[model samples]
Target: MTEEIQSKKNQHPADGQQRVVIVGGGLAGLSAATALLGRGVSVDLIESRRQCGGRAASFEDSEDGSLVDACQHVAMGCCTNFLDLCEQTGLGRFLRRDRTLWFIGPDGSRSACTPATWVPAPLHLVPLLFGMNHFSFLEKAALAWGMVRLAVRQKMSDGDTELTAAQWLHSRQPERVIQLFWQPVIESALGESIDLVGISAVRKVVVDGFLAHPKAADLLVPTEPLGEIFGEKLVAWLRGQGVAVHSGRAVTGIQYDESGKATGVVCGQDLVVADAVVLAVPWRAAKRLVPKLLPPVDESFVGSPITAVHLWFDQKIFDLPHAVLVGRVSQWIFQGEEENSVSSEKSCRAPAKEVEHHCQVVISASRGICDGDRNELLETVVNELQEIFPKARGARLMRSRIVTDPTAVLSVRPGIESVRPHATTPVENLFLAGDWTQTGWPSTMEGAVRSGRQAATQLLKMTDMKAECVVKDLHKNAFIRLLVGQ
Candidate 1:
């Protein structure tokens, strides 16, 4: 397929213009191409998979032949780069913003925690914390204090301490608060257990994700399937803008001249040439291709697992759209809505599908869970839902699936910052972009976009064209600026 398409399109870089070859079709590679739009540089984006969105992709349902997300991906308002890329590509309209975050307590109580829209930066979270029905007044107070302490004082924790989030919380916060609040929140965000995630990551979740701006916590969910939003729409947009998107082609290795400068990539039987290269694949793939260009990835990084439980019932069981489950095997539950039919065939106006009883439960850091027993895990999740929603007890389950990504995210351990490489490599023309890189963010869609844009920026500079592609952080108000000394 790649060879047939390669013969038709002008795959080579046009003469005289600096050409960039992006090696992966994930958010990182896609963003790298988008960043170079109208920059006088030609881009050839090669994606091994047929679809573009890497991890953030969808699968075809076996029964109905429709789209189902491999996992539910959401964006917090703090994800500036991710949101910017989506909006700039006109994919933002497909996003559904949920102002209120629903939290299901241990005792099956529901609380709607919504940050005050008009309130000041730090104070905007006051209503959000106090609204949690699960916590007592004293527990809430302690939780608030702990958040401030983590955000202000301990955010600058010394790298030598090697403190985990669990250790820091347990020392300063009450045990109940640690279990009921910090455990689930931190795990869900970092995709690692609180005991395993570093305190620096937790600080990022609090400060940039929560305290940075009033709108920072707003949740943006895709109304359309991720496959269509990224794999189809975004890809079409990039192609229309003259970016060469070569999908279904696996790049074997990087091509370098004797000077150690990247001249192009080896895709299948073709040596696709370029003046510069953006290696935007995951760490494992990057290390495999250019082993000497990276640090000892075996020691520098580790992956965290995430599981998604897809359940279909005869009738709707969940009353809320989405909720954060406290102290349970199921970390978060999303009540599936009738998804708009943005078919892979490029039917932009097809009739929307009326989905029924279709919902997803996400479990992060699910190592040692049920001892790798799928049946037991499914039973526990179903029973937990039945306990919380009486409707679920009687609803007949039609079908179910358990999807787990063993290495879903980069585990942000203490002292990890030292090993996280920058986009600029010693090879001069070859740049790196991935969520695993040093983007000052977690391994998320946001981090991937930032890394790609940063790589593009550095590459443009190498071509003697100075440009700033990565956008600035969200605007912080005076109070936040003064408090954080930003």
Candidate 2:
């Protein structure tokens, strides 16, 4: 490893070149590297893991030797920064966009939520919500009233950050609306229960995702595994731009000068110096590495857990690519890649008889079953699937694999947002980039990318270089602009 570092040092640009060292090769680090490289700045990205993508990553299935994601990560049309990064990295073509949302109720009733093209911004989902069977007419009316209140409050900047989402909605919405509509969306978006998530985060989700534009709520799922999207394709593009990509290199500590300015990073025994450094790691990792540079993060601002149950069946069970299971243990279900096709660079080729239908059931904010028996959880998911899809009742389970991340996403509690740091830290020439940063967004891929862009832009500004590399948000419609006072 020392020899390899020395070789990279030999290939480093001349002393005058403006080089950056980015620690953590996740979406945030990759985004920073891409932005810097685009501006002819040299970058060295170091990742502790063998592969990148951080939370949005995949691993080999020991049973079938197929690649499976740690958890299913989806994107909404409002995620402009994430989509921009995908397009820049040549991954835009691999995304599968679905405008309609399929909702399956507990008793096997189905409803579809499709936006109306003829309708204007805030009303685009009105027809679909009215037509849905999941909620009663009274419940829909209550939900509409709550949405209007939220929009008005957001426009007026009158939200109470001290309140939880559940507390905010308790008096306005009925129990049915809370369970049938609010909880699922809250869990899916914030990865926390309504009572645990902040009202500000909920407002961001409802406003930016649903009311901002007609297409903002459209969901995009990757047809390929996440490793291929963020690992192979992204790393290749970065390398093509003369960025030094180093994997399995853990940055032990950050180096600073007597003036309290970042100089470089320390990887084990070797120190790789740079003009600037971006610490794009998780909050816990950042606290451990640079405790003095960052503000004290609250101990209560921990992470929420997510669990993915991957199962192979004897035959196809789900007709749709993905669906949300209403009031079920499994929040979302994704139809895995079909047989005879490669899902990733490392996916295994299977024989004809070995080919089977694959499906993944994801449970977000899954604290209830994180420590439960694996077999019991698998059986519960299977039973829930059988309840929803009649075809799944007779399908034999070929194999099962469960993936859990205890610290999947940062818990967006009511007061936790105040603790999230900004892109620019106290240390000069040092920046922070992560999903946990203050990006005016929650902990999503979009937030991660936005933080990266923000950090890179700040670094460039400090160095007196071009700083407008980050993409802007999607334009709001005329009516929405008027409503939100944009």
Off by over 4 Å in 1: 1-12, 155-159, 340-355
Candidate 2 ranges beyond 4 A from true positions: 2-4, 10-12, 154-161, 298-300, 339-352
* Tens-digit lDDT track of model 2 for 442-461: 89999999999999999999
**Model 1, span 238-294: residue lDDT tens:** 999998899988889888889988888887667887788999999999999988989
Worst 10-residue stretch by lDDT in candidate 2? 339-348
Report the error of model 2 at residue 409, Å. 0.5
Model 2 clash tally, residue pairs = 0
